[model samples]
Target: MAKKQSNYAYIGIAFSLLVFGIIFIPKIVDRVKVGDITRNESRSKKVLTNSDPVVADLMYLEINGVPKKVPPFSFVNQDGDVITNKDYEGKVYLVEFFFTTCGSICPRMNRNLVQIQNTFSDAEDFGVASFTINPEYDTQKVLKAYADNYRMTNPNWHLMTGDKEAIYALANIGFNIYAGENPNVEDGFEHSGNFALIDKNGFMRSRQDDFGNPKIFYKGIISEEEKEDEDGETQEISMLKADIAKLLKEDLVK
Candidate 1:
């Protein structure tokens, strides 16, 4: 009986220590000054991370510096309507890829997107398009449910999926984002977190080539304070939101 009582006492002490550590470890961590840490300009200036100049497929017609045209294809959206590149004409859209079951960066990316949608809820010409990398599982029903789960009711925001081959081709050969099955990757599929911004004329907003030619989708800007959660968006996303407004204004003027 005494031994069992002593064992209980030990357990109680251990639990108390755990609780105490949980209460103060973060405070200790906050005060542990390793040294004077020099931070690079806290503001991330127009740093386009993935935007690069490149051309593949001979049909790669470009305009004013970004890939102006994309391979024609049709995909079903959450509303079950077939959306083709033609639907994107005269509109500016942000496109990206993610699986419904993604447990990593997708959540963060999607959260950023949610803020973006809210930021420009009244804009008719701006849209957000998301493609399911795991089309096999992300069926129309699943996509709709996922969008609904996030309160994504904007008619312009479309979640899509179609022929696996066509989608993969569009991800790789079209958007320049590598989308395919990779046994080495945690999700069994590899893709970029970068979003492609397509402009009103179907040309992707992009950087110019050496001699002045469209080459690739404009790279997004990212900064060091990107991890703040209160703003509900990353620094890069903030930059994107600003750029989207710039493009929308440009469209209105042109």
Candidate 2:
């Protein structure tokens, strides 16, 4: 009788542990999922609590006041040709700063940029530019390899690399985005993965945090407009296309 009781006690403890595992395992997994979503959302909003003030200030630039010119930059493309400001003249360029080996936000930003490229496929005036902050490591060959991995063979998408100081300076001062080498770490540079939209007139129109919300991703480009009645109000409501159309229409009037 005592022997039977001991066997039953052992069975009960094993059953209890099994039941607890079954109940808690999924909760742990769900918590991890929620944490990932929260992190991604924070990145998308560009709300890096740990980031420096210079980084935050650079992410949001004013549009109407003093005109901000994207300082001239010279970088080699994947094809090894020299690319400069003149290369993007009279075009709408979507600019993003990233390092190829970044494991966190770079892939998300690249995917969103690819979506934008597909959306504006027929628009010849639109282009995308990605600048690598880690110039020392991200040589033309490495950038070419990265571009090939993404299958980004489109002429409109340019992956550029130049001197490390020049790229970092452009990110901090010219583009108003924070980018620098990690002081404590070697090789890689830390940068916010925000996309900047530059209009044909050489104005920085919008800066989008790529990992934030899907709405922020498409907020940059100009969209086409359907003609309205004599009232002059817009008929179709495409915010991105409408903005672009408005800019183009204003240019035509000028």
Q: Quick one: best lDDT, which candidate?
A: 1
RMSD (Cα, Å) for all candidates, in order, is 23.3, 22.6
lDDT of 1 by residue, 1-254 (tens): 99999999999999999998999887666655542233222333224312332232212235444445665868999889999887877777888888888887677667767778888999888888888989899999999999999888678888999888889999987777777888887878877777777766665664445667543443232332464445464455655676677667553223
Question: What is the model-wide C-alpha lDDT for candidate 2?
Answer: 0.67
Query: How many residue pairs clash in model 2?
Result: 5
Worst 10 residues of 1 by lDDT: 49-58
How high is each candidate's TM-score? Answer: 0.64, 0.59
Q: Write down the lDDT that model 1 would get.
A: 0.71
Stretches > 4 Å off in candidate 1: 1-67, 207-234, 252-254
Model 1 alpha-carbon miss at residue 143, Å: 0.3
Output the lDDT of residue 237, model 1: 64
Error of 2 at 53 (Å): 38
> Could you tell me which 10 consecutive residues in candidate 2 have the lowest summed lDDT?
213-222
